[model samples]
Target chain A: MPYPKVDVDEWRLSVKGCVEEPLHLTYNDLLRLPQITQSVTLECAGNKRALRDPKTRGEQFLLGAISNAVWTGVPLQTILYLAGIRPEAQEIVFQGMDVGFRTDIPDLLSYSRSLPVTKAIHPDTLLALFMNYEPLPAKHGFPVRLVVPGWYAMGSVKWLRRILVIEHPFDGPYQSRDYVLYTRPDDYAHGVPITEIQVNSSIAYPTDQQTVRRGNQYVYGIAWSGSNNVTEIDISTDGGHIWQPADWIDSEQRYTWRRWSFHWKADLPGEYMIMSRASDESGAVQRQQALWNVKGYVNNSIHQVKVYVE
Target chain B: MPYPKVDVDEWRLSVKGCVEEPLHLTYNDLLRLPQITQSVTLECAGNKRALRDPKTRGEQFLLGAISNAVWTGVPLQTILYLAGIRPEAQEIVFQGMDVGFRTDIPDLLSYSRSLPVTKAIHPDTLLALFMNYEPLPAKHGFPVRLVVPGWYAMGSVKWLRRILVIEHPFDGPYQSRDYVLYTRPDDYAHGVPITEIQVNSSIAYPTDQQTVRRGNQYVYGIAWSGSNNVTEIDISTDGGHIWQPADWIDSEQRYTWRRWSFHWKADLPGEYMIMSRASDESGAVQRQQALWNVKGYVNNSIHQVKVYVE
Candidate 1:
């Protein structure tokens, strides 16, 4: 998709809906507010879409659909508090300037998604203006983008144009139709909205079918969990038959992936299968099989690799 | 295990038992015969032992317990034909010069394994003297190692010292006791002998949790089958939601792994789960779950990885 062009001089972030004051703030006004910076990991909801069984419909994404960066922005709660959010407001909807026509939808629609009032008031939620210490690139929702720390990237609407505080739920296309996980392919009525990222881990070294000289080798990878911090990582050099605890290479942090490594000696010459399983403080352990959903959301199965030692 | 020293000048390979003619051949005499070279992949029967759910015993080998090498040697059939096998012969037993005392067995025992006469006489079976164009390394069964191309490495008795044509099945410890796969963990009477390698594949690039720049990326891996050739490789960029056919990087060859790759474009910055599933000409497809075995043998489950794109 091409980046939607926005002229900063005429840009205004409109904050309306169930609030005491409806405010229109220019780009400079947002920059003038007290700024904060934080590092967060963002993962696409459809990250492992291709790994789902029975298949799914959408862009087939691999593990590279996620990234981490330092974002600079104003706390979303500050804006909500300044606007004096009405007590009756049930949800806050953020809309993007980018518009597109979808085959499933009759009218051209601007991308938008909603968050509960509780989440909107959370201090970690941000109206981000900068990524990695620089102004956001046009592709990354320049001018302003909503950053929801614990939810999937789909909830973090980009190219912010307006915010609406609604007394009831917002049934937008992205919320009502897309990004909904239908247990049965045809059962859309009981679909569930994808939210938190699942606890997961992946093997990074001695990659699948990688051949290495028989000796000491390090099996490295990363692990992450939504909201909760990753607490343990297990390494299985021989597939999942037996697991040995792995050491953390990075300290624990919320909303960011953790790096881990296991010291392994490939003393014998032959083929091997390697695996990594992760668990989070929330007590979520990476399973051998992820639940099947029509949209292929939230897959956190154990990662595996086949390696050869020569 | 340390390699035992062998005085080549005085060492001889004895062929006896049910053979019509018993014979002893010196190292130089065997080398003078017709020689052939082939690339074969040898896997340990206990490979992926750590992947077994219940956790099997023995050396906790990973995928590296296997390797492919160009072996030069005289076919076992040529030697068997010279020795003139009798019609009553049922199996051919091969023993290594190395001996050891085990806790389970009181007396010293040589590492011995037997093969059916049909497998023993197969033209592909060899008494290998050279590995990758070089003389066999001491640790890799110096002098002559029985190279059973399609079977597990357990059948390839190293440090060849003796061969026997038996009228009945050889009930050696390596055959009836150790290498046997007990289905119920205690069902000694219903155990199966581990043999032929299963069809399998592994991803070698975009390692698990690897962060790559959003652009064109090559997802590379390798696939191999026991006696059959790998006919297809399917790549899934999203956990397993959908699959696309992968291109073969190397032509199909028997007994050796074939390289494969998928050209992937990490156009968007996010997390993705990558997987590779392989199918052989024998109609064997790499499944999501490997069957549970007491010894964790023949695990050919699909391989996966988690990668991040920036």
Candidate 2:
């Protein structure tokens, strides 16, 4: 979908519902508050959707949908504290200005997703004003947007306009009808909502199907896990037959990707498949194949690239 | 491999061997000569190497290895005419300064390739000095490079230094061994050298595994062929089970890619494997699968992208 053009001056972020003090804040009003900057990696839940077998329904995203950026914004908890959340509030719903009609639904709906009150009040969640040191681009979310670190990017709602403190469990389309993993169409009641990202790694150099002369070469890539830091990365040069530890190129950090590299002596001439596997501090290792879901979400499979040596 | 640094002032292009008048021209001398610009598409011979079944030997390039640009250069025929080729000259050999030692060979070898004298003297063959209105970048080839239009990019030798008119066939590694298609280990002698590009097409948008909501959408991509213009492009939304002609978005042109689009009314929700098949003026159509070879060269198969409609 195209980005919605929002007039920054006319835009007002409304915080209502079960809040003790309903508030409408202009862009400048939020900017005047104490701010913090953080480097965070955001990945689409549907990344690597193309690799899913039997094919699932949804936007088929490849590995390129994940990225890291430094964001400057007010803590979401700061706003919630100012508005004073009611004791009965059960969830916080974030709604974006972008809306569309669904083929299966009769009414037009805005893109919205709700988070548990605990997560919404976390200090890490932010009402982001700047990304990579610049005011948010319209495509990302201009004026203001929600940044839910460690979780999939869908929870970081863009073009945000309203925040409602609800007294009951929220069941919006994005929260209940989609983003939830359903094994069978009739199993909607048992569907699980996607949350934390799984441990994952991808090969960036010696791209798939590249031909190289036999000799010394460096194989490198990036790895990330939700909430936890990547502790190790293993490289397999012989089609996963054997694996060797890769050296970390960057220091361990929270909510950001870690770079790793392995020096490979491609001494023989022939075809080989190189794969990277990552493990998080939580002892979570990337799987060979991700469990299949109807929406093809949370694919954290080991990444592989095929190369030929002559 | 990193680009070879050629000091323009110290560099001299030598035309020798079977030439009637051996000549050495400086960078400034070549710059003083008349030049012409032409838009041409250059595709690596190993493009789509990953798509080859049973796997092939070489760099596994995807569909991105092909590109079009306006190249500025002096006609190679003009320089060959100045040097005056001998009547006994059977082939013209072009050599680049980049050299490296191979594990199988004891001596360091420079990259080189040869073309028949007829193709060498063709008016379209060029000694390119600029690409897309800018001087050749070091990564591309600094100072000068050979641009063989209508042929696989392997023929366009980069970091050019020597031009030799030979009385016999050239048996350089690039010319007779690497770029040749070998069906079996013992088929080296009968391996065919890759030449003109085959008719081909690729979907640029609505990438593989992309999910889209049911509605009106445009499926667009590019198509190209060697020498001949693309005559038609057919899009199949049902995994090649059906084919519909696509409308041309760009005027038909020789030696460059043509853009085509199809307006699709996606009324239903399901899985789709969108495919594009292109036919050229020569009546050549993209095949379902390209003929397999050890080097994986000249693959011009129809392109397919899987998408989900929600």
Instruction: Give DockQ per model, in order.
Output: 0.02, 0.33
Give lDDT tens digits, candidate 2, residues B10-29.
99999999987998999998
Residue-by-residue lDDT tens digits, candidate 1, A204-281: 676655566677889988999889999999998887888999999999999999999899988997778898899999
TM-score for candidate 2:
0.85
Worst lDDT 10-window in candidate 1 chain A: A53-62
What would the per-residue lDDT of candidate 1 be over residues B24-140, giving only the tens digit for each residue? 999998889999999998888776664454555455554567788999999999989999999999999999988986545668989999999989989999999999999999888
Error of 2 at B71 (Å): 3.0
Q: Give candidate 2's whole-model lDDT.
A: 0.88
Candidates' C-alpha lDDT: 0.85, 0.88
Best by DockQ: 2
| Runs off by more than 4 Å, candidate 1 | B1-310
